[model samples]
Target: MRVMGIDPGTVVVGYGVIDSDAGRETMIAYGVLTASVKEKPAQRLSILYKSLEKIVLKFKPDAVAVETPFVSQNVSSALAIGRAQAVALLAATNRGIPTFEYSPAQVKQRVASYGASSKEQIQQMVKMQLGLSEIPKPSDAADALAVALCHLSEVHVSGLLGEQTPKRKRRSV
Candidate 1:
């Protein structure tokens, strides 16, 4: 399966692509799409949407996974992140690709075996899992990769469960 992961932000949106088959995985691409803070809010969103559209077209991933924004006391920041995440969803949905959402904690847990894993831990785990020589740059890209890995792990577990035979339920007297 080919998966594209997105970490949405108004100023810098991160993206990562990977292909998984059987048990092996390969990193296809990972990077960030930036928009100037000086631009108007609409323009910034436009920039992100268009850039993500181009990426979706180029890589043509089978599934798109996005990291949900971490809710915080900053209301405006949270709203902006939500808008950026919508852009990512549109980029995939417009192309008829399946999209999944994963919370930051879930991504961290799947990648690092702990829901509260630190950024450095996530970066290290992502690097080691992908067999990269060093941690992915700019942090955001590493985060995006973690999102993708989380989706991959979820799908793998689901598939394994699907393969198992179900036991019949018994009614109590």
Candidate 2:
């Protein structure tokens, strides 16, 4: 199964695709989509949608794993990121893909064996997990891959689209 991971932001959206089978995951594609600060909020979201749409069309992932917006001291920044997060979800849902949202801490714990793992630790762990020679760059791409890997570790593709959804929602963990 292929999972598309997303790290959403107004200025930059990171995406990573990974294929998992028999408990092994291989990296398929990873990159960042950038939006200029000069663009308005709506324009940025539009760019994000179009960019993510193209990715979904190209990769044809079985599911999407999105990083939930992290809390920020700045309300405006947080809200902007929340909107971008919604766009990421929409990008997958529009294509009839099931999207799972995970927090940064969740990704870190699943990928690096710690909830407070550093960014460098995450990059290294992701690289090692996928057997990549070098760490994924731009930070965001690695983060996205981490998100994807987390979902793969926690849930299977069948669970993503089946009756497991309600059980997943009700789980305390």
Candidate 3:
């Protein structure tokens, strides 16, 4: 399966694409979509949407996994992240891809075997899982890869249990 994972943010959205087959995961591409602070909020969103569309077009992922926004003390920041996530989802949906959202804790636990694993630990694990020599640059990109790995693991387990589809929560707009 080819999967594209997204770590969405207004200023810097990270993405990772990977192909998994026969219990082996291979990294295809990983990078961040950076938006300038000088741009207006709407303009930043436009940039994010365009960058994500380009990725989806280039990779043609079968599935998209995205990190869900965690609750934050800063409501405005959370809102901005939510908006960015929405755009990311829309980009995938427009291309007929099935999108899955995972929480940060779930991603950490799946990738590192600990929900409380630090960012460094997650990055190391992602590198180790894919047998990469170096950690993926831009922490957010690594995080996105972790999200995709988590979904792949979940799907594998589900298949073992003879399930065709994994449980997913529908996001209400």
Task: Compare the candidates by TM-score and give the number of the best one.
Answer: 3
Candidate 2: clashing residue pairs, number: 0
lDDT of 2: 0.87
Q: Model 3: clashing residue pairs?
A: none
lDDT by residue (96-144, candidate 2, tens digit) is 8888888889889889989999999999999999999999988899899
Q: How well does each candidate superpose onto the true structure, as a TM-score?
A: 0.93, 0.90, 0.95
**For model 1, how does the per-residue alpha-carbon lDDT over 1-173 read when each residue is reduced to its tens digit?**
99998999999999999899997889999999999999999999999999999999999999889998898899888888989998899989888887888889989889999999999999999999999999989898999999999888888877788832111211111
Off by over 4 Å in 3: 169-173
lDDT of 2 at 31: 97
Q: Whose TM-score is higher: candidate 2's or candidate 3's?
A: 3
What tens digits encode model 3's per-residue C-alpha lDDT throughout 117-139?
Answer: 99999999999999999999999
What is candidate 3's CA lDDT for residue 125? 98
Clashing pairs in 2: none
Worst 10 residues of 3 by lDDT: 164-173
The numbered model that scores best in lDDT is: 3
Candidate 2 wrongly placed segments (more than 4 Å):
156-173
